[model samples]
Target: MKKILVTGATGQLGSSVIETLLKKMIESQISIITRIEEKRVQFQAKGFNAFRASYDDVVSLENAMEGVDTVLLISSGDQGDRMQEHRNVIDTAKKTGVKHIAYTSRCLNNRNTLANKLMVEHFETEDYILSTGLKYTIFRNILYMDAIPQFIGGNIALERGIFLPAADGKVSFALRSEIGEAMANVLLSEEIENKIYNFTSDKAYSFYDIATALTDLSGKTVKYTSVETNVFEGMMKQRNLPEPVILKIVDFITDIKHNQEAGIFNDLEIILGRKPSGLKNGLKTLFGL
Candidate 1:
């Protein structure tokens, strides 16, 4: 039996991946590594082997990898020093003689002209993972449809407008749950190795499309307003968003404006064995109506 350890086990993606794994594999074959003791106890209560591991603590990570054959090294949430954290995980995994690593990364249409500074760490981490000479699978996930609500602000119905810096570029957003399921299936399979898979929806949607979907779903007139990057930053600041977060959002929108996330790929369908959910359906699910 394969002993698979998943990092970030309490996170949304990680939780969904575990849900999927529970159906495919026995509980004893799975382990979870989390920084929080409460989450570790929660998993343990459910009969899972859970460990306390922090990305900043190399010794904890090495101990977590003991007797584990495969690891799902989910990307760290911290944008500034996440690459270093990922390096710690990858290096420790290598030291422990782990067989395979499935890393989650961002989809870059063109790495050479990547406008999103937040994505630089992902590209760099991929390079570092490759350099370690370990068998790995890089899942280049696209923007999540689950994030549209946050991107447009929580109350889009009340706001009646979609404010963004993205000009008219389209993005292929996939459901986070579906992406998690596909990732779990990939981790359980043995066919793919040392390959990069683009996990994106087949259809792409611009902000205008998103606005239209919102209008139709909510039965209200919602419009997409394209603003300058500085203006967007000012609006975010007015909302009491932190400076670092505002900058990250601006960079991501700048990438969208440059059509850096417009690529549509079939890998998601190939992995899921079905067409990925459409944006309208995703929005409906997200809005819960």
Candidate 2:
């Protein structure tokens, strides 16, 4: 019996992964690792083996990995020092004698311009993980379709338009839940060392394409307005967004404009045994219309 432990167990992706796991295997084969005691208790109440562990604390992570055959090290949420936190988890996983590790990484291609500052950490982490000589599977996930409304701002529907600094770049976005489910499938499979999978939808869409979809679906006129990068930053600042966050958003939009996220891969379908969700349907579910 393989004992699989999932770190960051309370997060959106982690929780969805756990939901998929529960359907495929017994709860006794799964363990949840979370920093919050309340969340641990919540999982425990639902008949799961939950442990308290923080990526910042090596001892807690090692203790949590005890007797665990495979581990899902979901990337940390902290932006500033996430690489270090991931390092801790990887090192501790190696030290604790874990057999396999599956990591959630960002999708980055050969385009140098697409390599934003935040993406550098993922590359470095992948290099480090490969150096450890441990069996690892890296899932390079694309941007989530759920984030479209947020990226366009909250008033997209009301304003009947989408606004962004991004030019005409297309992104093959997948639902977070779908990606999580596929990842659960990977974790449950036989150990494959140093394999990389791109978790993205079959079709890609631009912001203008999204506006068209909205207009067609909602019976309302929606437009995609491309703004200058500086102007977009000013708009975010007017909304009282912090400087660091504003910069990150700007860089991400710039990457999109450069067509950084336009890759379509079939790995998702291979794992799920069906085609991943489409953009129009995903947007419909997101907008609740």
Scored by lDDT, the top model is 1
For residues 1-289, write the lDDT of model 1, one tens digit per residue: 7889999889999988999998879877888898789988988888888889888899999888988988898999874478789999999999999988889998878888887766888899999989989999999999899988888886654366888989898899999999999999898885657889899999999999999988888888899999888888998889899998888888788888888888999999999999999988998889875
Clashing pairs in 2: none
lDDT of 1 at 110: 86
* RMSD to the hidden true structure, all candidates: 1.4, 1.4
- Cα RMSD for predicted model 2: 1.4
lDDT, candidate 1, at 183? 92
**Backbone collisions counted per model:** 0, 0
Q: What C-alpha lDDT values do all the predictions have?
A: 0.88, 0.85
